[model samples]
Target: MFQELKPIQVETLLETNKNETPINYYQCDSYVLRRDTTNSCYAIYVVKALIEILYQLRNVLFHGELVPNKGAQNVYKEAYLILKMILDKIR
Candidate 1:
């Protein structure tokens, strides 16, 4: 499904620490979240969601939530809709 994501081109922003450095967390091998911006920043959250969506579809292709059929395709397609929604809201 990676071929269909049409991945949203977002500039991922990481959160800062007391010394104003970026923060990163390796949330398992499938997903990792890194924060660099200050509070209220959304770029990181959006990126994290995108990554999660990809990971889910990738692993679900076998025998979990999605079968190796048409349903898996739909999950990937929704990510594009989400991208459009985010862009519209930002613009």
Candidate 2:
């Protein structure tokens, strides 16, 4: 499962008015945040991030803010698979 997992890429918006540039970081073992040099973006731990994402999704769903689009479907599918894999291992 870990082998098939891909790092999530995050990009910082440039502060045009402040003339500030974002600094690129090297990968570390912190397990919270890491820089993916190949992708030029920051990556986060899958399990941690996924759980937070699901929580947010639940909130949006309950509030009727979520749109059942293709992208949303993909996210739901991926989350289901990962959660199912973990449950299978535990059982």
* lDDT (CA) per prediction: 0.59, 0.60
Best by lDDT, which number? Answer: 2
- What lDDT score goes with residue 38 in model 1? 48
Per-candidate TM equals 0.33, 0.42
Over 4 Å off in model 2, which ranges?
1-46
Q: Write the per-residue lDDT of candidate 2 for residues 1-90, one digit (tens) a residue.
A: 765675765544222233113433432354224334355443445456667877787788779998788998898788778778878999
Residue-level lDDT tens digits of model 1 in 1-91: 9868968775543323233234443343555545434466555576687768766666666447655557657866786677678689889
Question: Which clashing pairs does model 1 show?
Answer: 14-35, 14-36, 14-37, 15-35, 15-36, 15-37
RMSD of each: 10.8, 14.0
TM-score of 2: 0.42
**Model 1: lDDT of residue 91:** 100
